[model samples]
Target: MENDAETEKEKKNKNNKVIVGSIICTLLVIYLGMATYFRTHFYFGTEINCVNVSAKTIKEAAKQMTSQMESYKLSLKEKSGKTEQITSTEINLKLSSNDEFKRLKDKQGSFNWIFGALDSKNSKLKANIIYSNKLLQEKINNLSCLDSKNIIEPKNPSFKYSSTGYVVLNEVNGNKIDKDVLYKNIVNALSTGTTTLNLDSTNCYLKPKYTVKSKKTSEIKNILNKYVSSKIIYTFGDKKEVIDGSKINKWLNVDDNYEVVFDNSILTKYMRKLFSNYETIGKTRNFVTTSGNTISIGGGDYGWDINSSEDIQKLIDDIKNGRTVTREPIYLQTAASHSSDDIGNTYVEIDMVNQHLWFYKKGSLVTQGDVVTGNMSLNTSTPAGVYRLKYKERNATLKGEGYASPVNFWMPFNGGIGIHDASWRSSFGGNIYLTSGSHGCVNAPYYLAQTLYNNIDAGTPVVCYY
Candidate 1:
């Protein structure tokens, strides 16, 4: 009976030992499984709750974190609701083992503790992104538009960029820029967020090439008035009376009653002084009455008489010594003929074929005289053409006439042929036959020769017909 009882006790002890061993084995398996899951799933330094999060989800959280960095680079930020979306997925996985739980406890206390910590870090990062993006947007909004006020008008107004200096578009006239159009374009471009614009440099610019205040019309008008009043008019020939109002008006191209405005600048001060103190002998009058009697002095229809004869003489002297008005150089025709208006109507004409020269005044013959020709042997034939009596001298000597005497006058006819007072030869008619007859000169009587020499100028036409 004692042996059977001991064997029953040993069997009971073996069954109890087997049951304890199975319980310990099951706990060890659970611990190993949880440790493996934490090791494979959690990021290092993450909270315990993050341990059981999938690796794929962790990678997605890293990607979302990188977005903040990207936003900073682009000068932008995520919208307000976007922060919540990022944090919900990144903060909510459960802890699965004591190792993961210990990591969270040491670093962040617990799963609930880790969740709040991560949410706080992410919230701060999102706020920074938002602030940075707002600042960038404000800067872009405040950027100034390139309008007319800011656009630089280069010196001399050129369409091209010059490294050394500005080039002129139109040096003679002026420069014209459309400021209104330029301003409008700049404003439009800025409103639409455009980067650059095209400008035209080819427009012609005026003399004063620069940008000025737009409302300076009065200053511009003053400058123009000064320029216009500086002009002066001059006339040639004898001072004749401007008889008719219409004639004076047509000549001046102004109204008949308009006042003549003269420049009183330093350039004309001396001229004004001279005219104020002197008396003019020949009047340049602008007629105002119908009888052609009323006259005026200077440029107006008002008269000022001379104080004395001495004043008249002084005026004449001033005119003679004053600087002559010069005109712009003009090229004249090269033809040898003279106009009828140039030479006076009262003049003389010499006819070599008839062997006589005649002086005429207003178609009436005043004087006539006999003439001679040159000898054929010496090749001193009288030339046949139109010529003018150039110059003369008294008490002249005749070298080809074979004798030296006090001749009264010397008249060179054509190519050294001259008529002079032949005092040495006392014979007349039949060529006079005096020493080879003559050398192309026409010997005339003394009195007629003296009168002809004193009356002609260089431009007088001497027609010689064979």
Candidate 2:
């Protein structure tokens, strides 16, 4: 009875041990089921593409990311310190259901739940992406900054002149959108999953074609600036014109080889205008004689005539050399000082109708005489108008194209005409010249000729009028 009792006790103890072992095994199986829940989901520390995907299933992770992407907005900076944005809607940004996602999901080691749970490794994951490049380009093109109407063209450097003289003006680069560069950067950003695009930092904006430092622009600016520094002021008797470097620069031209060329026509025109106003001679004039006689004179070669062509050439050279000067214009003829008619008071006056002669020295009557002029019946009348005294001699024989005559004193004023001693005739003045008059010569009395010859000199003005 004792042995049977002990055996019974041992069998019951064995049954208890077996039941406890089975219960422990069942608990272990349940624990494994809970822990391995991660087998189909991401690891506790898993990250994909820098996004936390830990404790998320494959579809859950994809949906979460896709939803987040729909609200994505790319911040863009523009040229003029302005900010812009590119929305997902504009580019048709969306997730693509492709094998890439599955492959990434497989790389998570989700089947080895225990190992995945213990792993703390970081991973960069690329999800399958789908976006419309054409839509993105179109959206960028439609931006207000990219609009042609809103685009600002760059200005080239300039050389300007003012009261301050030559000035080098800087260029304005302005605002310009570069389609190719911007498109490239945007495409690169999108492909690489970039969130921000800086137009200024990336050099995506179009640059100016001519900058202040550009070689060609700088060269032109320098040339023009140097050209404008020369100040040329032209002056006539009372007229003046100031030609600064600025005006000369306008008349300058540069070839591709950078050779400077000045406009000769402009200079010619300027000289022509100057001559039109300042030139004298060939115009009506009023004169006052030494004897207090006011005469309206219209014929003479005794007035100012500017040398336009030569002076203009000289002006061009002065401008090219960048000279600053104040000067008078070149002239061809000169008139009397402070005299309007170009004829001063000291001159000889003769009246053919009255056959009279008068001489004045320094505006005072010095001598007077009566004279017989050329024969009127033969149309050899003494020529009338203004002439200068040619010469004087004590005793001379005068030869003409038609006749020769002898005289004691000769004061020839007009061509082949003179004041001479006609001792051969006893009378002077009046109509003896009608039938027996000297050919185009002034026949005077002997004593009168000596007096006139003693007073007159060469180059003395002789006036003869009817």
Candidate 3:
């Protein structure tokens, strides 16, 4: 009987322990379920835009954010260090649940909410916003700091050439009404559910059209300085004309996009001035002979002609490269050098009226004699004006019109007409060619033709005139 009672007491003690443990586990499960339920709503401490939304559902949190919108304010700071405020009623702001709230709500879980509540951290949601742009602009424009008289016009930045180089003029950010950007600020603040829109921190203001800090400004300045700092000089004998930066600077221009534009009219006017001052082609000249005789001569392809098209490009290049040189101008038809008379005293002068010839060398008469000209009565007369010596030959046959004559020296200056030795003619000049002329040649003495041929070379000027 004693053994049965001990066994029964042990069984009773074991059953009581099992019952106490079962009660403890049941109470703990109830506590955990309640904590998870509360956490599923919102953590112990949660804030959305500084509004307490702890343990609240998505609809409840949205309701809390909406209530704060009515009393919201926007603080705008001006360039003059003045602060401006706008009431929520002015802009008609409305609070709305943004993606931030949805994301926070999606992250709430039974297991994760436990650790979040243990951390005792404050979680805040952004205030997504909406507002009327027109109302925002009206309220901003009505501010005391933004009055009509107080408003200043914004000026775009510019670049001007100085003595040193191209300099940038700072953009003038005048006190102007920036209703456009201020209206955007209202929308931004409403979207993010921000109670206070700070203009100073957000950089929301009226801005100038251009700024010196722009990359295009530097690009334009580089091009302007390249043209403005260049130098070019054109030389005319001892006189020279300089195209300096002051003149070139006038040709430079910057468009709205900061692109460089050179005014070709300025270059045209300058080139016109040069043409009027120094051009000498087609101008009448007073010709003086080697024998000290003066005659007026003009109207021929016998003077310097400026190559306007080619030289203009070269001049522009030299100016861009800053070249300073003293040399003769480029010419199309060059005549020795640009001076009083292109044909100097060192040339062969044939006086058809006097029927005389003079060979001048270095302003001194080297040879002088008479020469038979073409038969004028027969209409076979030698053409007048300036020409160049074509070539010279020795022991050449002169063939023309049933006549095959041979000469010791042949110096042709004009077409088939030339200076040659004629053994058939006994006397020269005095209209020897009037009836019995030797074609259109100047029949000099046998010795004179050889002497003249040996002295002058090709390209020597031969002035034939009456």
Per-model clash counts, in order, read 10, 2, 6
Per-prediction TM-score to the true structure, in the order listed: 0.31, 0.46, 0.49
lDDT of 3: 0.72
Instruction: Write candidate 1's Cα lDDT for 1-466 as tens digits.
Output: 8999999999999999999999999977775665554443333334211212222233443444344223221111111111111121122221122342223223332233224335433212111111232443333333232224533343422221133222223322222335455445433333222333443321211134332332232333233232332222221233222112221111221112222222224323433343333322222423222223333322211122223334333322333232232321111111121221222344444444445666654545556676555554666756554344556778777665575556779876455666676665564344442335466676667767777777655444344444
Best by TM-score: 3
**Across residues 90-178, which tens digit of lDDT does each residue of candidate 3 receive?**
87777644566656766655445556645433355655666676887677668875688887777667887789888999988877756
Residue-wise C-alpha lDDT for candidate 2, range 1-466, written one tens digit per residue: 9999999999999999999999999977876774677556676656654467777777888887777678777778877667788888888887676355556556665455556645544234556567998898788888878888878876555556666654557766667867788888876666556788988789876665665667876667666666677777877656677888646766776543444577778757866786666665554566554356676755544356778887877787777677899987777654443245455667777776777788877778887878888998988887766666777887688887775777889887666677788877888778777877778888887777777788877767777766
Model 1 TM-score, all chains together: 0.31
For all candidates in order, the CA lDDT equals: 0.39, 0.72, 0.72
| Ranked candidates (TM-score, high to low) | 3, 2, 1
Q: List the residue pairs that clash in candidate 1.
A: 49-93, 159-201, 173-206, 174-205, 174-206, 174-207, 175-205, 175-206, 374-440, 387-462
Clashing pairs in 2: 49-125, 228-245
